[model samples]
Target: MKIAFYGSSLLSSYWNGAATYYRGILKQLAARGHEICFYEPDAFDRQQHRDIDPPDWARVVVYDATPEALTKVMDEAADADVVVKASGVGVFDAELLDGVMRRAAPHALRIFWDVDAAATLDEMRADPDHPVRAALPGLDMVLTYGGGDPVVDAYCGMGARRCIPVYNALDPDSHLPVAPDPRFACDLAFLGNRLPDREARVEEYFLKAAALLPDRSFLIGGNGWESKAMPANVRHRGHVYTAEHNAFNCTPLAVLNVARDSMAQIGFSPATRVFEAAGAAACLITDAWEGIEMFLTPDKEVLVARDGQDVADHLSTLTADRARTIGEAARARVLREHSYALRGAQVDAILRDAAAARAADLPEMERA
Candidate 1:
């Protein structure tokens, strides 16, 4: 299948947190012989801060963030076997959604792949005339990076033909245990672009904990936090490049995964960093959210914190041996059950089954 994927930058993780999610899943889809061409708009200074060169698995088309450029890509994408307009392209998202629904060939599978399903759903609900709400009936399927049953039922209820959660997973080939680098060495490290919905959680779960453990070292690696004041013990390394993520994950005694407000409230929505941290065998501590047991075993593979106090409590008792034990267990669990190979195959089956179902329906309609 020739897949045309319109998304945020695949070559940069600058302000775009979904970069690895795209690379991980798409790479496996390509491994299964599905040709992929990623269309990304040049915006948000992402091109200026490329984390990776164009990868072999997907041919990336970098276009201007203009209406004309969007139109050109939409025309080219219409011919693909699969036309996907992933959410959060950071430019012309509504138009892209409309394009995927209206421009794709009737035979082509049209997917609105929502990387941030929880938030997207929230927006769509508040604004009834959102492009996604309008496009749901016409789309072939809605695939989310995460947002289990709640998201599926919501989209289906909103007239989507099909909705599936393709949870984020590790790319073992691309991410694995690397020797710890000193630059990232800390007791706890977090790597996420600071955003409105997530900033308070970061402060509560990460920064507050940093203050509690005044002796422990803390590192923050992401954009938009340079100006944000932090505790004395915390160090901010604004925008750690994707290349250094392994080191960033490995060097920390433990890594924390903070979900955006919607994701935490929605539950079953694991951030991509959770798997990335697990891939590098970093002991994981995540904010309390529903359905984590579906992915990793709590207390054994991961630590769940309800608040800043819980975060501090966990770190205070966490010895080096315990951290290592938890990290190893988390890594093993994810590698066995949560790798992108599995995610890709899951998506492949979903696409195939949907196509087959459509074919079956076609003959019946013709007979009618």
Candidate 2:
């Protein structure tokens, strides 16, 4: 199947979380012999700042979202078997959504794949100016990256024809265990951008854990955290690249997972890091979240840390043998069931079903 994706940034993940999600899914889909054309706006500055280029597997078409450029690309989108409008394209995404719907051929399937479903829904409910509102019903299907049942039910209730959660998956080939570097090796590590909503949780869980283990080395890697004060034992290495993630994961005794407010509130939504860490056979200590058991079995695969004390307790007590055991179980589970190939297969089935149902609804011209 030929698929066209309209997402935030196909080539850059600097400040774009959604880009990582797109890369994981699209690469897997490409591996399955599906032809993919990714459409991203030419956000030159953002691209330069991030310094990432599109992968070899995808044919990336960069265009201006200006009226003239959009007018030209509309027909190309119409020719695709499936045209997906992903969340967070930055500017005028709602306009892009409208243009795609208006231009798509009658047989083409239109999907609204929400990378940030919880935040999108929250904004939609609170504000009248939410752009996706009018386009929701026209969408043939709605797919989300993170939200659990509540998100799917809410979209369906709001007149969506169908809603599915295609959560994050690991690319085992790209994210497996590797030799650890002494510089990166630490007693505990956390890697995530410093977002306002997650900062408090970081303090409560990460900082508190560091405080508890003053003698133990803790490493933090991510952007937007350059100026944040840290204890002597806590080392901050800003923004580890995607290529370096495996090494980073392998070095950590236990990797901590922190969810943003929206994800925490929505529940059951695992971030890409969770899958990446687990795939790399890194012991995971995640903030206590509802529905976590559905993804990674607690006690067996992951450790749940509720607060500062819980985090400290885990760090101070969980032995290396236990950590390795947990990491191994998590890795086994992900390799067996949660690889990106598995996710691509699931998405392929969903698209096929949607197309079949649409065809069934239409009457033959000869009969008419």
Candidate 3:
């Protein structure tokens, strides 16, 4: 299958949070003998700080976010077996959605892949004129990054033909246990962008934890957090590149997973960071969210923290051997069931079934 994706940057994680998800899924798909072409806009200085080169399996096209580029992308997508317009492209998203919708072949499986399903759906509900709402009924399927049953149900309610949650998973090839980098060595570390919806939770779970454990070292990595007043015990490194993720995860005694308010409420939505950290054999302390048990066993594979106090308590009591045991367990679980190879197979099956169903319906419609 030839799949064309119009998503955020796959070569840069600068401000593109979906970079890991896009890269992992497409790389696996390409490995499985599918042709993949990724189209990303040259926005946000992403081209200036290209983190990783595109692998041989897929073609990466970076273009100006202009009408001419849209025309070219549309022409390329029209011939694909599947065309995906993902959320949070950060430039002319609505125009890209419209272009894909207009150019996709009748048999093509057009997908609205929502990386931030909770936030997207929330906005759609509040505003009837949202572009996604307009594009929903026309697309063949709606796929999500991690939102579970609730996200699927919401999309169906909003008039999607079919909706599926393709949650984030591990990619052993990219994320593996490596020797810790001395620069990021810390007791607890967190890596996430400073988005409005997640700032409060980061404050509650991470910053407060740092204050409580004044003697322990903590590190923060991500963009847009330069001016925030962090605790003295915590060190902030702005915009850690994708290449440094494994090192960042491996350096910490424990990595923190703080969910955004929307993601926490929607449940079952684990961001790509969770899989990346666990794959690097880092003991994880995540804020309580729904459906986490399905991915990792709490108190065994991963630790659950209710608030800053819980994080502090976990840090205060955890022995080095115990932390290593938990990290190992989590890594084993992800490698067994949550690799991108497995996820690629799942998506392949879904697209095949969707194509078959559309074919079956075409005959009946022709007779009518």
Candidate 4:
């Protein structure tokens, strides 16, 4: 099957969370003999700040997103078996969606892939006049990276024909544990960008824990955090690239996860780092979330922290042997159920089913 995707920067992940998810899922899909054409507008200085290049496996078509270029691709997109319009293109999402819908054949499946389903749904509900709301019913399928149940229900209730949650998955080969560098090795580490809504949780879980362990070293990575104040023992490394993630994960005694406000509110929405850290066999200390146990068995596979005290206690008490055991168990679970290959296979099946359904519904003259 041939699939076309219009999303943020397909080949760039710098300061972009959705790009990482796309790269992992699409790369795995390509490896499984599916053809994918990623249509990304040459905007946002992505070329200057690219973190990951398009792998040899997939075809990436970069367009200017100008009127002429968009018109040229409209016909091509209409011919694809599936065309996906993911949220957060940030450049020409509205224009691209309009053009694709205008030119698409009745049988071409249109998907709205929402990486930030909670935020999008909240925005739409608050203001029905939002541009994307009008496009929802036109989509054949609504897929989300997170917001396990609420997101799907909201979209379906709003008139989407089908809604599915395709959660983030770990790429075992890319994220497995590796030799930790001394510079990166730390007693604890947290990697995520600073967003206003998530700052309080970060303080309660990560900063407070680091403060409690003044003698132990801690590292914080990700962009938008360079100006944030940190404790003396806490090291801030701004924006570690995808390639450096495995090393960072392997080196940490335990990696902390702090979900954004939207994800925390929606529940059951695990970030990419959770799967990546687990895949690298790094002990995970995550903030208490409502549906975390559904994804990772809390006490058995992961350590749940409700506040600074809980985080500090987890760090102070767990023996190195016990920590390693927990990490190994988490890694095993992720490999068994949350690998990108598994996600790719699931998506492949969905696409096949959607295509078959479209074919069956077509009139006799259009069936050819």
Task: Estimate every model's Cα lDDT from 0 to 1.
Answer: 0.90, 0.84, 0.90, 0.84
TM-score of 2: 0.93
Instruction: State TM-scores per candidate.
Output: 0.96, 0.93, 0.96, 0.94
Shift in Å, residue 299, candidate 2: 1.8
RMSD of each: 2.0, 2.3, 2.0, 1.8
Residue 119 lDDT (model 1): 89
Between prediction 1 and prediction 4, the one with superior lDDT is: 1
Residue-level lDDT tens digits of model 2 in 221-246 = 88877899888899999877777888
Residue-by-residue lDDT tens digits, candidate 3, 1-368: 78999998989988888888888888888877889999999988999888888778889999888888878887888888889999999888998999887887776778999999999999999999999999888999899998888999999999898889998999998998999899998999999999899999999999999999999999999888899999999999998888889999988889999998999998999989999988998899999999999999999999999999999999999888989999999999999999998999998889778878877777655423
By TM-score, is 2 or 3 better? 3
Question: lDDT score of model 4?
Answer: 0.84
How many backbone clashes are present in model 4? 1
Model 3: residues with Cα > 4 Å off, grouped in runs = 363-368
lDDT of 2 at 300: 90
lDDT of 4 by residue, 6-39 (tens): 7877787776777768988998888877788888
Give the worst 10-residue stretch by lDDT in candidate 4.
44-53
